[model samples]
Target chain A: MNYPNGQKKIISKQATSWQSKKSFSNRGMSLEDDINTTNQFYLDIDRAVIHKKPTPVQIVNVHYPRRSAAVITEAYFKQASTTDYNGLYRGKYVDFEAKETKNKTIFPLANIHEHQINHMKSIVEHEGICFLLIRFAAHEETYYMQAEKLFPYWYDKLHGGRKSIPYEKIKLDGFHIPLQYQARVDYLSVIDKLYF
Target chain B: MNYPNGQKKIISKQATSWQSKKSFSNRGMSLEDDINTTNQFYLDIDRAVIHKKPTPVQIVNVHYPRRSAAVITEAYFKQASTTDYNGLYRGKYVDFEAKETKNKTIFPLANIHEHQINHMKSIVEHEGICFLLIRFAAHEETYYMQAEKLFPYWYDKLHGGRKSIPYEKIKLDGFHIPLQYQARVDYLSVIDKLYF
Candidate 1:
């Protein structure tokens, strides 16, 4: 993922500036869109079968029109009980949640839900590969933090400790997912290095 | 998972008959409900991490109130590109589409979609465990048909062959999933015999 020294600095500066201009949180239309494009590329090349689960909705009412599709007249979003993305990768169960933070210092622990942590715990216990993809928008970096690493932090938060993982801590412990041409969020490469 | 062994008619037969009368045209509300409950049982006991993906919906309009959660005003169901349920089981990626057929002699191919077949093809190619959970409500029998077994029928249909799988053929080729108190479908035992 090496770029010309000048080009790398220029790109970093532009992304750093995006922290303020992009008021929209990554809950998640930006990083998610890139990951989806990356997943499609992986699928086209016969690499993996990862997909973001559809947004869960509670349908309250439906209007069935004659000679037309049933329209949902009233519905509400349901909080997910599991991670946002999961699938098979290289004959292994891959599960992960992805989030982007504009914060330059730390990633707030509140970005993740308690149930999601429990879900990750179960995946890890079952010997499946589980992790988090944390994107620091200020630095334009995405880190792959293993479920094992995340548990301690979540436990610490529950124990009324620091409510965030410092950027430096993540930079030291997490693998930097390289930005690529087709696989924009090239995570499998990191999985290969760590697991394979 | 063995029951009293005398016809094994413990599960509410009256409800099954009622469900067939109001069958959702093979969209599988009856079987889907049972499978969802079964999956929860699996998760509770730490046997598997299977989940039914949320029904895909196209949100057309949403109203954001100042002091409450956003409500979807208009939406429509979208066709799923993949199967309904998938997750990790026995360290293997498990994927399947569950459907119930009231037909006594044949399971219709129309119950599945073209994209789902392609998605199954991909899963099989990647060495993931993929299959179909076909339940015959009339006979109260459920069969676990492997993805490999399903491909030939799909191709045959494309080549102007039979548009449905015969009940007898399924009985011969597919494994019978045992009815259980917890794992209602109990397909993993069949998986143990085949893939494990």
Candidate 2:
């Protein structure tokens, strides 16, 4: 797979920094991978049950080879209706989207979809615990910000506000998630402090 | 779509009666579809926010044809790691599996997967609301039975007990969900009565 020139440069720089953090060498792994590993860790220890929703697909056709499993021959990816990760966490429905940005000053709102913002709003309205696990990759920092806190910036764009959230503001509003050996992105600890 | 002779006969009879229940005309629709529609009704009114997890698929290959959307050329169905439907209902986590049985006298244990039972067990362990929305298609009845109640029956089969739960026993232990105009399988009312 090939990334655009600018993104490719960022990837190379990320790979370089990944080497320095040799203990956590897997830092080069995508934020999604880290969270998946963390969720698996949670499940293993019976802390919380969470999972990433499968990529939605619109299957147009399938072929059942004589004795093998049916193969999807014609299909297209479908737009997801909700955020990827969601499950039960201490009796509360936990819903969130994980995203990362390379920008030093801001996290572009463009990385998030309007429907996803709306979905997060609905989850909040239903009294679920919703948030965004955003990683400022350049700073090697991940923060857990509640969905309610994000709505202002999302709606601000409609009211002629900045298109991206200033990293300084996020640092003030979001809780820094600590990284650990087994629990890669230990966001649940932040959840315990914030909600529980 | 083809079923064995005896099962096919049951399906034909089902199709015939499905047309007569014109009010619940969507009787031909799968149990999953009915619950999805019911969940939509709840969402539309801001009563709850729930969604069905997309069918999991293993994408082996994709073709990026020019500027058009990428076409999935090779993929196969994957077993889901969690329940079909889950979300927040009045500040609590609600998770459940929907399954239909053609048998008139009993609901077979084969309809429930071992992993799903374990998943439900974990949800209950975390104090979340978990249950099975079982539909007896032959009798045209649906029941909402809590997962904790199901554990004994599930374990009973593993310990050389009955392979199926009799319909009479279910009627005794499970709450019957009545069908309504817009909310076809209004299981939330049962949840309210039982959980709230």
Candidate 3:
């Protein structure tokens, strides 16, 4: 498919059915959708109260038709100053951002934002559960890197280091999140091992 | 002015600069906007962290332009299961819903959803700061009613009684939130009186 401005769209041969079925086994669906489903499952089972924060959108213009509902005619996404997910679990606040990439060698630090890093740092200082869920999509691997481990490297990146976190370094510092039938992400298992 | 429905359109007058400058003595802005501005001010001052939860919308269709941004062609408002705002304040969880009505006689319980009532109950049970900011727009009066005070009445609504909370009852039960320049709503002052 060709987009405007002469940009070519590369279509992958990934089957929709296979992706839906193996969603728990690999980084199948978009990270956001998978995490939302996982959070709902957790809520259903009374395991935790985690939730995906809704995308902040600024609605500039709204049209209210007499017979129909209100229509958001114009809106734009606002820059989020916090992590994607947060909730209370076992009397502790859990805060995290989940990201997935197709790259096999490294996870780019550019995927994380400075404001998000600062938010995580504040959460850590306040004795909250803070971490990042990084998924290596090509290898179907997911790792939970604690905020303390990522803080030093993030500061180093500011001082002219590589813009990507190497897979080997992630493997050395992060804990592998278990894949489960119910809690697909099962990040709490990693949290249990590291914090609890 | 007139609308398509053959009804005269009464334009809401915008406050002039001089009028706005004297707003601290008057009713000032809408309760929703005041709370939002107060939250932003709190964020800036490194005070209690709080935010208004985004309105949930279910997208039915989307028009993805080749070059331009994606347009939401069709969508519907989803009933929110929780309150409008929630976040941490002084290491404590704070959750609340803000509602406004021009009615002078009473505040209808119908405005409060059953799911939201249940959610507030759970939050209170978990020892969180939970309340409702009720605005009697006709009187230009705002009150902060604790969730505990409202729950019994909410549960009683299903039994047999008026399906609304009368203004006289609220005057007796709710705390009158003071209007302020910076913290417009200044609900924490009520919190200080009630909880602290």
Candidate 4:
């Protein structure tokens, strides 16, 4: 396959075959759910250990529903200081953020926060595997773009370039994550190829 | 000073004098407030960057109060899979659970869940620093007890022993966290002495 920018796309035939067999029928699985299922599979198989960080919530008002249960009556989402997924993999810390975009031609840099980029930089400096898992829903493709490729483009965007990472650039620079039967978002396969 | 068990208490006279002069005020502070202040101090001073995991809430109902804000009308506290605080310290992963006890003579083991203990064990197996910050609220004394010491006692409790860890045992096995001007918990000081 080729993009508009004339970049050759390395589409995995095996991944396409797996996607065809899978229906993802659990209340319409979101990207988060798929990643979580993948992480669980990794844990069960004793592969790379990974987990999604619990959603940060600030409790303002809580009511005692029963002796054992406390019902939160008021709360708000709090900004997370670190990326969603971070854990040790083969004696090295692996950290990454997962985001999905509906845009066919571009992946919006705005989907990622400044702090997340900084966090990824620190992880990279500390000799950890750091990257972003970008999913283009329109194309039904997921790419694992390393922090080195992301930071320069992110800075360029800050200096008034395009606000999105071109699909062609992602296709060229990123590793496509294979969707699996057990590990729904099987990102570790990409990590194993790229890092190890 | 000597306990009924005939163990000589290691009371630092200098520390006592320092505490008297400082007048450590536990009256005005809630457990949450003290922890937040301590975390801020940790971050500012570059001492063991630790943060409390945010309270997990499952939002079920929401009301649009205004165009700008959505108010959560109903939610419930989700069961936490891991302990409260975790972070990196001096290239070592640090994970711990903090609890406060009103009892003067005993710290209840029942306060800790089995899953939390298991999580701490896994952290220890991975060469991470895993411990518990236990505060005896009645005496205004806080101690950092290593998970290794905690496990045996927890098992003994399961076999019908006293449900609480005796204050004397805590004093012997755990490091007494000194109250400091900048860092309220001053746990890293104890960690340095015990681990590093």
Candidate 5:
């Protein structure tokens, strides 16, 4: 999925420079930034209606002042009970969780919570198209692994087997998602190839 | 769809009394409480996978203590871009917004925002089962109206027609969601009647 050498170099160099310099104040954002940009492009063109669900927060306290908005004063992040992104595509239900890991060898199992795994299982049971978008940041590669494929690993972990999935195993089993200019992660292309 | 006379009377009396007594601290909840309870029952029995999206929030500032969970110090409620709830059911994507109105004669269009109407239009265009759940609190009734049926009114409002939909019109055009002891707002029966 490479473009011309000069073009790829220029684009990535600018992204790396900006992300490294401008985002220390907002650390750990650029990983999902590509997907967000991609989803927005999809929405703008009316290709799909996917959206990243809002981060779940537990509001414990609020302050209301006259002639102003109510401000949340105390809150905490709650564990999400479902996948991060889901929407309709081609008249089918599409659901997925996107995650990025820096580890070069294996994707640690702990990156996904138990409840999210259960939710994915329920989606599959109901015949919805469910999958995971995993990015290896160091390798600059994304893979689309269907939820059905992830269950064996989840069961292994439950039965006290390997705690992480090897990079090689994912490379063999998962489809490599080509990064497109407009749809950055471009997982929908993989979904098209697999299903349609 | 009335249950045994005594059963319905007891449940209504208990709910009205409890809601009046205990829910002033959490205003505007019981209307959705029925739906939420219904959804939970659906989940427990593996009937459908539906969820009310967590309220969208924009977090501006947070304070992280060395030994405690991060506390959000400043945040604001953000206008939701899509409907309030969505999930897969019987291999179909179901998306809907739930609104409760105290008005007995009319369901105000002002309860829904312009952007949300645009989003619902997109959902219907993509062939998802998109609808609205309107609860007339004063009348103790909930009605399900399809998104396609709503476009005319939405456009009429845009062109300086009636600003609100009358209760009588909703009663005629929409399907009255029967209240079951288990599936309190039983809209799925209407869905089966309409689509399947």
Candidate 6:
């Protein structure tokens, strides 16, 4: 009973049962799906309480015809001011943004917004665990780079440095997230080693 | 200048500056507005980073006309599975649901959803600070009640007990959130006292 729409199915109870599978070894799902599955797994075992924020939408007009639910007739997509996923881990505040890039050589800085960068900086200043989850879809590899580490490259772009992070550089700096049967992207194990 | 529409003014950046008025003593605003203003004040002083989750919407049809932004032609409101607000404070994970009631005698349990109650329970089990911010709109008083304290009443309702919490009980058990000039609701002060 897999739905074609990822967002719809993820919100449904069926998705929770779907994740009960022993493995997703070669399913080739999107990075969002994998992370959502991992989050659901974390929630089920009382390990963490993280969630992906809903897509921001700007509503202009809504029509109330009859007694049914009011329908949004005119609306536009709005940019999110913060990251996609946030939650609690080990009684510590964790905040992160996840992005998937098709490029094989580099991950572009344009994938993240300026406001979001500022938001992450503020979180780190407040002693929160902030990071960026970068997924190279071409290579099927993901890395978790701390916001502190990424700040250097982000500031370099303003000073006429490269606009993207090279794959080799990420391999050197960022921690690789291993995929597993229960915890799809076991990034927390890395956090436990680094931050804790 | 107060706008006629609530949504328009809320999503605007100018609203943050509007809170420069030393106090919200006379200006009657909803609990949500007060909390947002308080959060902005916290952020300005590097105190905390808390935000209310946006209202969820389910998009049915979207149209891309010309080079402008993508317009959602049809959409419907969706019920949120978790609480309204969540974030980090003092390197600790904090999660809470805020609700306002006009009732003067008791706070009805029906104001909260079963899933939200369960969600908060799970958050507490994970060793996260979880609570409810209940505002008595008539009296203009707010109280912060720990989720652990509320669990007994929540379970009692299932056993044919009282469906509402008496005002006297809340006054005895819950901590009063003093209204302040800079921080409107000043719930964080209560959090500081209890959790810290």
Alpha-carbon interface RMSD for all candidates, in angstroms? 14.1, 11.4, 11.6, 18.1, 13.9, 7.9
Candidates 1 and 3, the one with greater TM-score: 1
Which residue runs of candidate 1 sit more than 4 Å off their true CA positions? A1-29, B1-29
Each model's TM-score, in the order given? 0.86, 0.86, 0.79, 0.78, 0.86, 0.86
Give me the displacement of residue A182 in model 3, in angstroms: 0.9
Stronger candidate by lDDT (4 vs 6): 6
Which regions in candidate 2 have their CA more than 4 angstroms from the true location?
Answer: A1-26, B1-26
Q: Is the docking of candidate 6 incorrect, acceptable, medium or high quality?
A: acceptable
Q: What DockQ do the predictions score, one after another?
A: 0.28, 0.30, 0.15, 0.15, 0.29, 0.35
Give lDDT tens digits, candidate 4, residues A34-109: 7888877776665655667766754556665344455556555556777887665554466789887778999999
In model 4, where do residues sit more than 4 Å from their true spots? Answer: A1-28, A45-49, A65-68, A125-128, A189-196, B1-27, B45-49, B193-196
| Fnat of every candidate, listed in order | 0.52, 0.59, 0.06, 0.22, 0.53, 0.50
lDDT of 4 at B75: 60
The local distance difference test score of model 1 is 0.81
Expressed as tens digits, the lDDT of each residue in A1-196 for candidate 3 is: 1111233322222322212233543445656666777888877766666777765544444555676555554443445678878776655567899888778999999889898998888777656788999988777778999999999889889999878889999999998875667677888777777666
Specify the poorest-scoring 10-residue window by lDDT in model 2 chain B.
Answer: B1-10
lDDT of 3 by residue, B1-196 (tens): 1121233322222212211222432555777778988888877776666777766644434455566544444444456767888766656667899888778989999999897897787677656788999988878788999999998888789899678899999999998876778988888778777666
Give the winner by DockQ.
6
What would the per-residue lDDT of candidate 2 be over residues B35-141, giving only the tens digit for each residue? 87898999899889888888786676777667566667766766677888898999999999988887899999998988899999999999899999988887788
Give candidate 3's error at residue B165 in angstroms: 2.0
Looking at model 4, give its docking quality level. Answer: incorrect
Model 6 misplaced regions, further than 4 Å: A1-27, B1-26
DockQ, candidate 3, vs. native dimer = 0.15
Q: What is the lDDT of residue A36 in candidate 4?
A: 82
Docking level for model 1: acceptable
TM-score result, candidate 2: 0.86
Off by over 4 Å in 5: A1-29, B1-29
Candidate 4 residue-wise lDDT at A146: 92
Name every residue pair that clashes in candidate 5. Answer: none
